[model samples]
Target: MIICHCQSISDQDIRAAVDWMRAADADTIITPGKVYHALGKRADCGGCMPLFLDTMRQCDSFGVATAAERPPILRPARLRLAQAR
Candidate 1:
């Protein structure tokens, strides 16, 4: 279950970090770097990146917010005027 061999990170560690982050800030975006920082570690070799990303993707709160979930996009005044005309 070790995701990062260099940093000695486990699947449990990843899950714990993710849960803690989500609890701290629901809107906060979780990434491998943040997870590593949360665990008081950092990525060493670039090799573990793929597995690291896979483990992160396994987490429930790992995806970006959908358009409907995000705030409405606003158009620039010039663009709006052009469209209106």
Candidate 2:
């Protein structure tokens, strides 16, 4: 399915870009702009954003990871043992 008509980006393209990005850098954040760049395209009209985002969300790699879900808290285990502090 075409997600961004202006860029001719499809759902597979988006997923491929996302997976490529994730593979390139696990800690990197994925965005539509990056996907466009990866596919060597750009956004024209802003109209496709809604469907674009919907398609993006369908990817398995499209959500916040557990570590990024919330800020860490100061604790004895983290500060003394794990040193995550």
Candidate 3:
């Protein structure tokens, strides 16, 4: 499934790039521009953004690398702890 027609980027390519980026730097922020840079291309137009974002979120390793990286306040337990303090 092609995600970005301008860059000739496919869903698989995006997945691979996402996995590679995650593996390379667990804390690194992944974005469409970064993916395009990784693939040696660029976004020609804003048309593919919706599908592009969907494919990116579908990736398994598509989130923060560790529990600490996630927003602590977002967790109920942590929220309670913060309130306690």
Candidate 4:
């Protein structure tokens, strides 16, 4: 299940990278570039992006939690007033 032919990356490699990244930093956003970096490889042709993204999406720890799962950001009252003005 080679996902990126240019980088010789397989589905397993992608999954393993994703898992490792999630374990290392639970809040870090996992992207294709990060996956490539984690695997010590880089994208060459850009043709595998579709399949690469698909494989990444299939991983259990591939995505970050929705806004609901995290605390809402708080802006200063002065900033809010400035924006309103």
RMSD, every candidate, angstroms: 6.0, 6.8, 4.3, 6.1
Model 3, span 1-85: residue lDDT tens? 9888888999999999999999999877789899999999889997999999999989999885455556665446865576569
TM-score of each model, in listed order = 0.72, 0.73, 0.76, 0.74
User: Which parts of model 4 are misplaced by more than 4 Å?
Assistant: 64-85
RMSD of 2: 6.8
- Model 1, 63: alpha-carbon shift in Å? 3.8
Q: Which sequence of candidate numbers ranks them by TM-score, best first?
A: 3, 4, 2, 1
Clashing pairs in 3: none
lDDT at residue 68 of model 3 (Cα atoms): 56
TM-score of 4: 0.74
Off by over 4 Å in 2: 65-85
Query: lDDT for each of the candidates?
Result: 0.79, 0.77, 0.86, 0.82
* Winner by TM-score: 3
The global Cα lDDT (0 to 1) of model 3 is: 0.86
Query: Could you give candidate 2's per-residue lDDT for residues 25-85 as a string of tens digits?
Result: 8777678898889999989997999888888878887656444352344233444444443
Off by over 4 Å in 1: 64-85
What TM value does model 3 have?
0.76
Q: Clash number for model 3? A: 0
